[model samples]
Target: MEFKEVVGRRRSIRFFEPDKPVEREKIQVILETARLASCAVNAHWLRAIVVDRDKIPPDKLNQLKTPVAALTLDLAPVHIYFFCDLGVVKRIKGSRLRELVDAGALAPTHGWSHKFVDEFVYPQILEPMTNNLQGYLAAAMADCGGAAQNALLAAFDEGLGACLNTPNPVLTKQVFDVPDDWVSLWVMLVGYPAESWEAGGQRPRPPFEELYYEGDINTPFKRDPGVVEKLKASKMITAPAPLPGRRQEILQLAERLNLPM
Candidate 1:
């Protein structure tokens, strides 16, 4: 499908064919696409777990409560659970630590080593505990969101469907056995579009100008209305076609994941 058509067709599909199983290799490819997503200092905090319907327990799925998340998690052939590793920040110490130590902060005679450990190392350890969990969460969320979006688009390119759904991190962590420091961010449900309706009754997105601004909230640019309409018609803007080699990379990812597909 063209990017425009894929974007136009992309919808938060809650209903799915319970009997159909998503290809294992396809799921691997999508995750591979997500893995390539960019992150600050190459700290790829996001860890995605692709689970099939049978793997998700009934009571656990019910725990989601919301219709969207429940159906998405329950009915979809595959679910990718996004997680963030807070410990990844420790990798920042390698080159940075050498620079800090060489800069005289670790001078043994002045007891700067003690000061360095106390001032920097201790603070790095305590920061997460003292600071707002929500703040750190938001940053991790933004990091995963890009990767999830990439995954969704990749699915569309592969002639599959996917929807980003909300899931309780508390429940997900327990169900998936993710470490305490590694928190659940969200869930992406993937499958073939099995609904009878075309595009699953999707509505038009809000006008681009109304939502986007130039510099501040007040300052607005005269967006090219025609461009949006054109893209909307083409489905390119909504579902951007994968770049060259993206699909191939996803296929290779299947090998790494060892998924059945």
Candidate 2:
């Protein structure tokens, strides 16, 4: 599918085919896409543990589910838990940045060199930031979020359904044997959708003008109708949610799945 179409079609698919299984290759593609995402300082803090639904012990799986995501966890065939390693910056100590300099990606024209990293970047910048745990965690998590989004998009591009959910952190760590320095981010539940691909059409969002600004904070960016039309034509902008028969569809699905309406 076209990139725009893939973006358009992405939905937080909560209802998945419980009996179906996702292919290993598709899962690998999602991970590969995430690995290629841009990271600050090339620290590459993101890590993931993919769990097969059927293989997980039932009791442990139950413990891993959060109250809001209980049904989602039970239904998805695969669960990918994301984390950000807080120790990465301290461990690498700007070696990754030096590698970029050596490879010419971080060029001398940009004032990048091995000496620059060791002297100014590491001791002066990175070390101090790492010492302040809260500030350091926020930056690392932001980088992890980018990588997770890439994985999410890849899932849709591979013709699978996925949703980002908060897992039970205490149980997640215990069940997965997570490292002490690894902070939990999110769990992506993956499978084939039980509902229609449109998922009742595109979800709602705040008005574009309210969300963006131009040169001044008071000046809202003027949205061009022509560009909007172009995006709609390319399937990037789709119909709003709660399509016709949506309620009936949900009712039927509830009955079939033995879920309360």
Candidate 3:
């Protein structure tokens, strides 16, 4: 699919074909895409634990599900638990940055060098950030969000359905044997969709002007209707959600799956 179409088609798929297993290669592709996402300081804070739902003992799986995500957790064949490793910056100590310098990605023209990293970046900047744990976590988690979004987009591109869910963090840590330094983020529940790919239609968002600004706080970025039309033609802007027969579709799905109406 074209990139615009892929972006347009992405939906937080809630009902999945529980019995259908996602292919190993597709899962690897998702992870690979996430691995290639941009990160600050080359720290690469994002980490994931991929779990096969069928392989998990039923009791443990139950423990992992939160009140809101129980149905989603049960329906998805694969659960990818994402994390931001807080210790990565401290452990690597700017070695990854030095690697970028050595490879010329971080050029001398940008004032990047191993000596610069060791002297100024690590000791002065990175170390102090690490000392302020709350600030450090916020920054690292933002990087993880980018990587997670890549994984989500990859799932759609691979003809799969996925949703980001809040897992039971305490149970997740215990069941997955997560590292002490790792902070739990969302669990991406993935599988083949039981419903149509459109799932109704594109979900709603705030008005574009309300969300963005031009130069000043008072100046809203005026949206161009011509560009909007071009995007709509390219399928980037699609029909809004609660599409016709959406309720009937949900009812049928519920009846077929023996779920509450």
Whole-model Cα lDDT per candidate?
Answer: 0.67, 0.93, 0.93
- Candidate 3 lDDT (Cα, 0 to 1): 0.93
Query: Model 2: per-residue lDDT, tens digit, 62-156?
Result: 88888899998988999999988998898999999999998889999999999999999999999999989999998998999999999999999
TM-score per prediction, in order, is: 0.69, 0.97, 0.98
lDDT of 1 by residue, 127-209 (tens): 45325677766776687788888788888778777778768878778877877889777788888765422442455567667
Error of 3 at 166 (Å): 1.4
- Candidate number achieving the greatest TM-score relative to the actual structure: 3
Question: Which ranking of candidates, highest TM-score first?
Answer: 3, 2, 1
Task: Indicate the TM-score of model 1.
Answer: 0.69
**Candidate 2's error at 64, in angstroms?**
1.0
Better of 1 and 2 by lDDT: 2
- How do the residues 228-260 of candidate 3 rate in per-residue lDDT, one tens digit apiece? 999899988898898998999999999887788
